[model samples]
Target: MTGSLRGILCVLLSAASPAALRRAFMRRQDEQRKGGPTMWRLRTLASMILLGILGILLATVLIGGILDVRLSRATLDHQYEERARIAASTVADIPEIRTAVLDGDRNRIIQPLAQRLIAGTGASYIVVTDRDGLRFSHPNPQQIGRRLEEPVSVLDGRSHVGIDHGSLGQSANGKAPIVDGRGRVVGQVSVGILENQVAHQLDEEIEAIALYSAIALAAGAAVAMLLTRAVKRVTFGLELREIASLLQEREAMLHGIREGVIGMDAKGRVNLVNDEARRLLGITANAIGQQLDELVPAGRLRRVLAGRDAGADLSVLTDDALLVANHRPVVVGGRPIGSIVTLRDRTELEALIRRMHAVTGLSNALRAQEHEFTNRLHVLVGLLDLGETDEARQYLADLASDQLISAEDLRSRIGPPVVAALVLAKLAVAAESDVDLSVTADSHLDAPAADAQTLMTIIGNLIDNALDAVSAQSGPRRVTLQLRDDDHHVRMVVSDNGPGISAEAVEEIFTDGYSTKSPRGEMRRGMGLALVRRLVYRRNGTIDVSPGPGARFEIRLPLSSLDPVASARTEVSEESR
Candidate 1:
């Protein structure tokens, strides 16, 4: 009956739906309070109540299984004790049991009594033994009187149950107590119950409990699955919306970033390239899943993929155009998986750098000229003090006459007043230093088409350098300036008769802040040649300084490239000056 009640409780707990259980519990509470449920409260309260019920049901099942096993053990023990007491009472009543056992007599009556005790009680084996360690009767007896090897506790009037090998050498329970006719200590009567009997009963109870637990567990699992599914269904849309918004924000940020960003996968295939990356690469096709080299055939992209740390601003030329690229490895899990390559157009930057260099070169050359001119002035003063007044005066007058003629000649040919005046002033300075400075031009001086400041800077530096070079010489200082117009270009040449520049220094003479003049000399620190080179490059002109018998600087520029109005006005003003 108790088993049936337990089974029913297990079924009820297992079969109860989470919602039904929750509603049943809430209904009881509501009835006690005389209150009704609200829609919102019902939804939240239902889940909590269901979980609480499930927890209680699970704990109850576990505890019941343990209690059931313990109760079954206790009932088995009680049955065993009652049977043992009855056997003891029956054995005590045997008239010859005590006499035969105590007197060590093995009689037929005691044998039948032992057999009857075994058969009636359904014990595996029965033994009757005396206090003299003699087995008077046994279930299996080769001889009626055999000495028992068991300890005296069973024969000493104490009841005990335990496993032992019987007289026939088979496993059995030796449970029995010895009593005399007056209930004093005497021989023992033992009955062995088979071990399988208790094991079988316990097994049946355990199996029932396990079956009940399995059903309960299955029902709980089903309820949990249903609850999870319902909750997912209710919140799935909101989660998806949040995920979509997050993705959009990520894309927006990537697009808005200024640096060219290219994401590559583990296989070195381009996974994503932002808009700025496309613009930098000058490619419109989607780059996803494509090898980086395919989109931009430059070898730099391949180098990046090979796990090389291509430093920032690395220059590479693609199709004869230079690009500055920065390559960086994309690391994941402490391993280089791919790379990111960013590039910028460097054409204009290179051009500007060249212009700056040109300006610097010109500035240095001008400074060298100034230094030499100072030396020339010192030489003239020395010449006068050495009592060579006539020689100095003749040299001075000849220089003045040459300057006047060159100025008139240049003013008449080159029409620009500013350019012509500058030329005349340079010539006069040359003459005063006993340097021959002449301008031989077939066409008028043209206004600079590009930056006027750059043109003046270029022309001033070349003429001044020539004058300084010649001034340092002991012989007649000679300088020639030639400006002529070709079909497509304008050419200017300035040559001096002083010591020529060394071949090695010619190349680097135009470098900014480089000067061959000694710092101890009267020349200013490096600036003139650098400025000259910069101006020439700015005006789209090329100037080359070479070592001949003396220093010679040649400049060439495209005439058509010049601003027409400026060129025309320059010519007109030179002629007027």
Candidate 2:
């Protein structure tokens, strides 16, 4: 009886313990949910308030300082000009001053006039000198009756105003000739003023400006404080923690996604960058509060931020690695607020795509050859079935002769089998279409720098295009193929006598999905020129199309631009052979 009762008590205790532990776990989770947002909201609100204050203060101070300096300079210049004009006009009105020196009386007339001029103007000094060579009167009485060599301007009867350091230290002076009514120059009246006086005036104006600027700054700062307080009064009462948590959760959702996320404020400052964004940019740390350009270096990111929806791949090289960035603007309520940028590592994908294109091009060429072979076989069979042995033999002979002539011509001019085969294939097609095709190739192209497969594709596409262009002409259907190889590069030019391509179409012919042919046409379908352009770019080559009397497509590829590893492997295989 005792053992059974003890067993029942133990069972009851185990059942209660499980239920209590579950309740405790749920309570802990609830607490975490509540606390996380509260902390984040506080931080976000604080950051926003601080940043907004800093931006407003900086703009206000900068603009105010600039205005103050301009105002001060203008006021000082106005006062200085007024004072100089007044001094010049007062000296001009004294007839006694002019006559004493004009008559060349050395001692009797000049001294009293100089003293009177200085007293009336309250200037630093006045000096009167005769035109010949004598100082008749001077502020310093001892200097009177002395032989004077005046400045050249005074001797030339021209007035001069300048800052000078004479025997009397630094001074500014205005010198004018006392002229007679006949405009004949007499002696000179020299009025000197201290440089300190002008400087003092400027300083006074600057001081007034400074005082007013200080008052305005104080008022502006007070207003700013009041506004800040008002904003705080409204915002501080909010549940900052809850709002911050929601923002953090939203940001987390963005970061967790495969796409890169970036946000900027109105001041062009980066406010948010997710982990995926950092990784995409090859950045290891946070990029907040930094200029987007400083972090991205490529202006692509900045352009997206400036309300531009540039949906194109951007190649960016950071300190750590290269990135292919896709940038777009982030608009709120139909206005651009910031931007979103997505980055992808396209290096491997691009390399793979290039290889695939090369393989696919080779496959297509082989398929075309196979199709032609089947048609030739059918023609040969029909010739034999007609029971005309002699005619069949003659037809066979002529066919063999045409092939030999074409192949021999191509071999003599273009040495490589791949290029020769491409040219021969296009020649066959052009002959069937009744287009006159001419082939001119350099001897060096016998062993071209490009791989056999690449040479076939490049040459094949060009000749095919030329044949197609000439096929539509009603006149002499002529197509010319010229291949030249220099020490550094290979150049191919394919020209046709067909109605030339339009000037406007030439620029966009290489663009993807841009076709000149009708939608129902089967011959000119698919991404032909677009593929050509991609292949050319992958091989570090360039292609240009021009419309002259006829259509001309020029292709240039540097021998050294070939992939080094691929070239090395080919060289090794050739050496082994």
Task: Give per-residue CA lDDT, model 2, range 140-224, as digits (tens).
Answer: 7777778665543566666777665666656667767767788776666666776677677767767776677677667766766
Query: For residues 1-577, what per-residue lDDT tens digits would candidate 1 score against the true structure?
Result: 3233222222222222334334544654565465456543434433554566577768888898889889987677566545655565567557777776666663457888778777787766667776655676776677557776656566556576545555444333444556765777777666655546767877987998889887987788677657644543332212333334434554665666765666654456676677866776676887766776788764444464334534555544333233556666544224444555565655455545545644554555566667866886777798899989888788778767865886677777765666776676675566556676766645455544433443455677777667666666687888887766556676778788878889888866664335666542222323456555544564478888878678888888776556645555333222111
**In model 2, which range of ten residues has the least summed lDDT?**
7-16
**Candidate 2 Cα deviation (angstroms), residue 504:** 7.7
Any runs in candidate 2 off by more than 4 Å, and if so which? Answer: 1-328, 332-335, 343-386, 397-412, 415-438, 441-444, 447-479, 486-489, 498-546, 553-577
Best by TM-score: 2
